[model samples]
Each structure stands twice: as structure tokens, then as C-alpha cells.
Target: MTITIVGVGLLGGSFALAVREKYPKATFVGVDASPVHGQLALAKGIVDQMKPLDEAVAVSTLVVLATPVNTILDLLPRVLDHLPEGATVTDLGSTKGLICQLADAHPKRAQFVAVHPMAGTENSGPGAAFRELLPGKNLIICDREKSRPDSLKLVEALFSDIGMKLFYMNPQEHDLHLAYVSHLSHISSFALGLTVLEKEKDEQAIFDMASTGFSSTVRLAKSSPQMWAPIFDQNRTNVSQALGDYIEFLKQFKVLIDEQNLKDSSEFMARANQIRRVLEGIDRK
Candidate 1:
């Protein structure tokens, strides 16, 4: 099959590598706004060739929109308009509700699949791509019922080939769940990083004294603002609600600390420790 990937950054480039592993003979054509990224992807052999969006979509058996959520919103309908009759289209955007709503009334809505692969690192660019990124990861397919059977089957096969397990949810539920699980973590990391930078000021001291805990906690803060800003904008309401709840918990913790309630703090920590079981289950998978 001939596959075209738009936005040949980390997600797109990694996906190309994964697909190439499973379907070694499939031809890959990459499309990106950045000429530098396109050239790098070609040099690294991430894609067989690069082409204009319209030209690439015209010949592709499957088109993967691996761009940011806002870019996906703008590109989905245009791709559907130019896609061949039997071709399929899918996206790897983090937010789903807005994109799904935008395509709800399209004439060829059924030709597209809404997917969010629940895996990535705090890195971007073609150089960061790797085949192992998707293995054992969960892939969420939103509003699967809206997609044509053939389109859904094609997407399912593609995820299966890349060693991912699938979960199905309506767009609304997917967005709400991700607000708490994914978006909130990035917000927390960014806030923590900012707090330390603003207060500590001593860059050398921070670098010298930082431990693994600090590094891991602030890791998501290093993610690209260009990509995440659009996600926060698109899922503003849900993410706001998640942030509000998190702030309330922080307030409660502060009250506990102020009161010197050691027993209460221990109980609260014990409750949070229950997350270990949930994390263990994921590890086993």
C-alpha cells in the first residue's frame, strides 16, 4: 500500500518507521510544512519521498494526518475532498472532540478515522523518531461508529500492525478522560518548572542539585508549546475543569501542611498510593 504522512515530526516519522517494519514493501510519501524536517526525514530514510499535500493524497492508499490538532482540523476536510474513492484517512492528534465535531457534517466523514495514540515522549522533530515508540501502547479510536466499516477496518489493521492495543470511546468521553489523565499532567509539569525557575534563579545550583525525581516531574515541561498550545485551546473547557480540581487538591494539601496534621497527611498519601495497582496493570500489559 502507498501511505502518505503529513507533518513529518516525531509522531509522523516514528509511525513511518513502525509501518515500514510491518509492511516492508509499502511505499511512504511524507508531506511537511518545514523543508528542513522534510529533508531530514528523507536523509534518515523515514520516507521514500516527499510531495505536495494534494499530490501525495491523490496517490496514497492511506493518508495519516500526524499534525497538531489545529492543523488536523484545517486539513481533514481538504484531504477527504481530494482522496481517492477507496482511500482511508486518519489522524494522530491528541484532542479529538473539536476535530471530530469539525468533520461531523463533511460529505465524506465516513472515510476518516479519529485516532489518538496514547504514547509519546517530550521530544519533537524527525531525528527523534523511533520504531519502538508505539509498541504495547494504547490507541483510542473516537466515534468509531461514525466511520465506514472499511475505513475503521483499515485503521484497526494499521494499529495492530504497529503493536498497539485499541480502545473505543465517543469523542466527548475521550476528551474528558484525556483532560484529567494527559493534559493535566503537562499543565502541572509546566507550572512546577516555572515555579522553580522563577524562584530559584540559580541555574547552576538547580542543575547540580536536581535529582531523578525532579527530572521526571518536570520532563513534560520540555514538550513543544507549538503543539500543546493548540490542544489546550481546543479542549479548553475540559482542561480547565481538570485544572480546577487539581488546584482544589493542592489547597487541601496546603491546609494539611499548615495544620501540621501528620496523621491526615499520611492517610492522604496512602490514598494516592493506590495508583500503584493501576500502574502495575499497565506495566503487565
Candidate 2:
């Protein structure tokens, strides 16, 4: 099988590496709108060759889109037009509802699959990718029933072959869940970055005092603004709703502490401890 990976960034580069490792006979080609990424991907052997977008689609059996969400939306119609009848198309965007809706009535709609692989690092670019990233993580396949059965199975088999777990979700459900888990974390990290950078006017203070907890919480701050800013924009309503609830929860805790309500505070701490235990259990698994 020949696979053409468009975008050639972390996700696309990683997918190309995984496919190369699992299917030695497969030919992998990469395409990126950024000339720098295309050169880097080729030099790093992330793909067998590099090609223009239309050329990649013309020859490959599978076309995986790993671009930013907004860019993915812009490319959907043009990409759908260029795809071969039996070729499969999948995208690795964070939000799906909009992209899924965009591709719905296209003549090649059945050939496209919307995938959100639940894995990534706080890094971007071909150099940041590794083959081990996808293994043991879940890949969310949205609106599977709308996809051609064979195309869907092929996607599942490909992910499974690379040691990934497959799960199905509706686009709305995926967006809602990601808004809480993935999107919220990014916002928290961005806000935390601004807060600390403002407070520790001396960069040295932040460098000296940064501990594991601070590092963990603010790690997403290092992510590309190009990729994340649009995600927050696209999912604004839900992300805002989640952020509002989170702020209210923080305010409630502040009130409890300020009033010195020891009994309620203890109960609140205990409830939060349960989340710590749950996190520990997830880590163990």
C-alpha cells in the first residue's frame, strides 16, 4: 500500500513512520504546504518521497491529512475533488463537527474518514515526532457509520497494526469531550503562562522555582499557537462554558478557604483526592 501524508508535521510525520515500520512494503510520500517541513521530512526519511498535494492524492491509496483544523476545513472541498474513487481520506484535526459537516455531501464523502488520534506531545514539526507516540493510545473515529465499511476497516486495521486502540464517537460528542480534556488544558496552560510571566517579572525566578507540578500544568503552553488558537476559536462556545464552570469551582474553593469553613473545606479536599486516585489508576494502566 502507498500512503501519502499531507501536512508532514508531528502527527503526519509520526503516522508515516508508524506505517513504514508496520508495513515494510508500503510506499510513503509526504506533502506539506510549508517548504521547510517538506525538506525536513524528506531529509529525515519520514517518507519515501515528497510531492505536491494534487500529485500525492493522484497516486496514493491512502491520503492522511494532519494539518491544523482551519487549514483542514479549507482543503476539504479541493481534496475531496482530487481523491481517487477507492482511495481513503482521514484527517487528524482536534475538532471534527465542522470538518465532518463540510465533507458530508461530497461525491467522495464515503471515502473520507474523520479521525482524532488521542495522542500528541506539546511539540510540533517533523523533528518532534516519534513512532512510539501512537501505540497504546486511543484513536477516536467519528461518524463511522457514514464511512464506507471497507475504508473504515482499513483505517481501524492500520491503527491497530501500529498498536493503537480504536474507538468510535459522534462528532459532537468528540468535540464536547475534547473541549473538557484537551482544549481546557491548553487554555489553562496558556493562561498560566501569561499569569506567571507577568508575576515573575524576572525570568530567572520562574526558571528557578518551576517544579514538576508547574511544569506538568503549563506544558501545553509550548504548543504552536498556529494550531491551538484556531481550535479555541472553533470550539469557543463549549470551551467558554467549560472555562466558566472551572472558574466558578475555583471561586467556590476560595470562598470556603476565606470563610475558614474547615468542615466544608475538608470535604472539598477529600472529593479532589478522589480525582488524584483516579489519575493514579489511569497512570498505572
Query: Which one is best on TM-score?
Result: 1
Q: Put down candidate 2 lDDT per residue, 196-245, tens digits, no spaces.
A: 99988999989998999999999999999999988888888889999998
TM-score per candidate, in order?
A: 0.98, 0.96
Candidate 1 lDDT over 22-73, as tens digits, reads 9989999999999999999999888999999999999999999999899999
Cα error, residue 50 of model 2, in Å, equals 1.1
Clashes of 1: 0
Predictions in order: lDDT: 0.94, 0.89
Residue pairs in collision within model 2: none
Off by over 4 Å in 1: none
Model 1, C-alpha of 276: deviation from truth (Å): 0.9
